[model samples]
Target: MDRKKIVEIISNHYSPLTPECKLDLITNSKLLVLQKGTVLVRGGQFSDKTFFIVNGCARAYYLKDGKDISDWFAFENEFISSINSFFLNIPSPHFIELIEDSVLLEISRGNIEILSNTYHDFERLSKVVAIKTMLKQQERITSMQFHSAEEKYKNLLSIHPDINQRIPLTHIASYINITLETLSRIRKRLTRI
Candidate 1:
């Protein structure tokens, strides 16, 4: 991605970066082109890196008794990281997997800290990112805890209307905490209504 594209993405979510901050990011960040099924961080691994998805999507999932349960999905122009592991310096309970061929900007915590300390605006940028991440997590947890499987799927569609076009039904079923057969039934029922 060029500087202009980076600028546009940053500007879309947060405020436009200052010239120095932009230069620092352009110099420090690495563009990662990863194919589907690429696992960035596995369970029990410590991930100090955070990925900004410029294109495509990634899913955070947990492997429990050999069954993979989807935790969350990050789409284009969103950030994906092993949140607790990245901040707590501990092993991650979830694995971050690229679900599609992705273009990502990878930034290490070291670089983030450097930028946060050197530039005031970078701190603001970090705050904005943190807030957004927290809000997303909050919503996901709330849905998983309180919503029915059908309601969860409906909420997912409301949030990302085109998600079904990009993601597989199995992953969606896992994310919404339903069996694939149940999800199929739910979809059919919704279509009828």
Candidate 2:
């Protein structure tokens, strides 16, 4: 993987990085190509690494009563990390798994902290990303709290337009807090309209 290309992609998705900041980030991170079903972080594990998806997608999910419930998804140019573990130094409550074979840029929290302190551009970029993540989480919480099943599905679709093509129905159902059967019925009903 080309480090410069990776940095360019990151800059395009988030804030533009100063040349020095970009160079330091390139030096501190790693480019990886991982296969599908790879588990980056597991429940109860300490997760210090955050991955920027260069290609493909991933999800953060929890196992509840032996069922997998997806809480978040990240695709190309997006970042995925066990937020609690990464920020609070606590064990992760969910698993982060790749949904497809993926190319990723991996960065450690320690390096992120160092870079953020050393570079104003990196600090600003970090703030922008964090705010975006926080807002997305807030939106999801509001949707889950108030939206009907169909509304939730539509909202998710609006955010990730190609989600149905890329993600499994079961995972989508779990993310939307609906059963697979109900999601299928909703899809069918929507198609008929």
Best by TM-score: 2
**Which residue pairs show collisions in model 2?**
none
Show the lowest summed lDDT stretch of 10 residues, model 2.
1-10
Which whole-number lDDT from 0 to 100 does residue 36 have in model 1?
92
TM-score of 2: 0.97
Runs in model 2 with CA error above 4 Å? none
Query: Cα miss at 3, model 1 (Å)?
Result: 4.5
Q: Candidate 1: which stretches are off by over 4 Å?
A: none
Residue 58, model 2, lDDT: 99
lDDT of 2 by residue, 1-193 (tens): 6878999888878899999999999999999999999999999999999999999999999999999999999998899999999999999999999999999999999999999999998999999989889998999999999999999999988989999999999999999899999999999999999
Error of 1 at 17 (Å): 1.5
Q: Write the per-residue lDDT of candidate 1 for residues 1-193, one digit (tens) a residue.
A: 7745774687668756788888898788888899998999999999999999888999999999999899889998889999999999999999999989998889999999999999888888888988999999899899999999999999999999999988899999998889999999999999999
Go through the candidates in order and give each one's C-alpha lDDT: 0.90, 0.94
What are the per-model C-alpha RMSD values against the true structure?
1.2, 0.9
